[model samples]
Target: MTELTIVANIHAKPDQTGLVKTELLKLIPVTRKEPGCLRYDLHLDNDDPAHFMFYETWESRGLWQDHINAPHLADYKAATEGAIAEFTLSEMSLIG
Candidate 1:
């Protein structure tokens, strides 16, 4: 099966950038240890502090689905309930 690539863009509320960033950082350590996680990297926009992105590669779509339902992920959602302004995720295939 082909590897799964996930690109997630998160926009934090203007006043909650710090909190959202902190929370996003918290996911890295744990997520990297999960099964099927190949690469999980986070980036902050140079000119837009409130914008964050996650570039992830997973072994398979099913494993990635498991990751999304993890307890830590649920906690993250609850913790950042109103702090995020917008969130977008894209699943893709790497042709190169």
Candidate 2:
């Protein structure tokens, strides 16, 4: 596969999961505009409402790096900092 994969596991503070999901939805359009972005999807855990995750496919690590530097990303990161209890990111490179 040619897609660069990123999985983000997020935990919202207290009852803020709903708000976090709403805010994360805003990233959809912005990600679509990036030249090398393939797909970006946000999902809520079936067993844990306060837990959220994002699956993103990019053209390369370079494009993903550009995403982190984008102005909107700072706000995105900031908005979720305290509101998010925990955050983990995993980057994946395809094989075969």
Which candidate wins on lDDT? 1
Per-residue accuracy of model 1 over 22-95 as CA lDDT, tens digit each: 99999999999999999999999999999999999999999999999999999999999999999999999999
TM-score of every candidate relative to the true structure? 0.98, 0.89
Q: For candidate 2, give the lDDT of residue 1.
A: 30
Which residues of candidate 2, in runs, are more than 4 Å off? none
Model 1 residue 59 lDDT score:
97
| lDDT by residue (tens digit), candidate 2, 1-96 | 366899999899867887788788888888789878888888989999889899998998888889989877887887776788899999987786
Clashes by residue pair, model 2: none
Off-target runs (Cα >4 Å) in candidate 1 are none
RMSD of 1: 0.5
